[model samples]
Target: MSSASRRRPWDVHRLPSAEGSTFLVTGGNAGIGYFTAEQLAATGAHVVLGSRDRAKADTAMASIRSRVPDAHLSHLPLDLADLASLKSVADRLDLDHLDAVVHNAGVALDDPPRRETGDGHELMFGTNHLGHFALTQWLAPLLSAAPAGRVVTVGSFAARSERLDLDDLQSTLDYRPKRTYGRSKLAQMSFGFELDRRLRAINSTVLSVVAHPGGALDSLTPSRPPVSVTTAAERLRALPAALLVQGKDAGARPVVRAVLDPEVRGGQLWGPRVFGLRGTPRCEPVPAHMADAEVAARLWAASGELTGTDPDLGFR
Candidate 1:
């Protein structure tokens, strides 16, 4: 068969049944994360939304249930900024095995002199990068035995233009909010790629894949009552940009595809089909700089020490 014909068509609305599986989506209480959980839950998977606030999670879950009456969903109190609490959170998760974990949670300070986490690390890097690093290490046990399991790290298109400065990962010397945030995301994407290689070396069945939403605008997102409200004025104001960007609902496509598409492989980078900004999920080439093994290795080493989890021995 020809290459085009061999490719399986995907319908985001008509997901394959995953009745016996379970998924965890960090920051699943809102935005792209909420839509990710909602779509996965529609497939009959027991999806747990990892959020710092129980009330917000409830609102998001209720919105999801409003759309999917029989959806199996729950909440897990997760505070990525607090490194000490992650273990307890992992222990609290009552599941035999996890089919996938979407590292969709993140923090971005629009403008700041600089901020640090409770752990003394840069806020963005600590929460967005190291937090997920340690969480995955801790979640390894539940993922280890599941051959079809995946770890989907949600990266950012903004990270595409940024580079990592290994010496000042915490931005102690220099910290611009946007730059630091981009670097944090780059670090996370690098970690995802590194983890894929390490998992393969260890003969682990768990696969790692990275994805990014091109440009999802809040104004373009559909209103889901208390969960998300896109006012008419906001929609009208954002109308012109709709041609270039997409909604959080559409932005959720790539990660959802990464989680369930059998054809998607580890080390692959998926993004929007158009200009890496907005469209259906499409498998794309991994940019060379983004896939630099040496840089990822160094970041990996530093991450283990910083998080105090030492993923080398922590991840099963």
Candidate 2:
């Protein structure tokens, strides 16, 4: 493998011109999502920042425009935890063509209290996996209309730590904050690769790929949103991690690579080349559990049932 560097082959600076492409990034209001939008907008892609809060979405677009003065930017309010909100947002998009959708929004709460989404599913699983699943379902037509459009779902390296319980997809059987987060991410990866397989089987042009922002932290991340300021205690906790962590800018590379890298194919997973923590983007191996066909099928069916939205392959 090649060495990671300030200017690797997959560096965002080398990103090809996306002048005519349009990308919608979920959770674009902050963190890795924001940086992904910023980089894409800087590369001349028309970027729509998707968030639950309009104010935050506006602020995020403003921040991006400050750096990329000529950026083509927009915002669409989307609360992934709520199925109704997802439908409303999809209706508003009304796009006939979209180059890509970055499924980056996730429940970022640390040790969040046990909770459920509007539809009564576990919050993390509902938001991270099912929400994107439904959103992708609604937007499949628009994506298929585009020339070689792709869906890049942002997964997590933390997923490698845990296997999912398909029988208890919602974690109702045994709920632990950290473990639930990992399972939700694993579900996201499963859905992404499985979607790719189904799309291929159906001869659909749209592609699905997964990428992870390995070990990126807000503390070391520059241009962080004002609302994202870390407290003293938070900073203290991240001190050790700071040694291995990269900023959001660097972390966003894998995702950007997955989205726009012409050589990349559907079902490929990308992540940091070194230590799976901090480095340039490279095609990484999918976790064994994440690639399980039976698990993916079960999760897909469960997700459709939970969200009340089935995957539409743009078929009539």
C-alpha lDDT of all candidate models, in order: 0.92, 0.85
TM-score of each model, paired residue for residue: 0.96, 0.91
Candidate 2's TM-score reads 0.91
- The C-alpha local distance difference test score for the whole of candidate 2 amounts to 0.85
Writing each residue's lDDT as its tens digit, candidate 2 over 168-259 gives 88878788898999889989999899998898888888889999999898766664556366667766777787667787778999999988
lDDT score, candidate 1, position 100? 93
Q: Model 1 residue 23 lDDT? A: 93
Tell me the RMSD of model 2 versus the true structure: 3.7
Give the least accurate 10-residue stretch of model 2, judged by summed lDDT.
1-10
Q: Model 2 Cα displacement at 147 (Å)?
A: 0.7
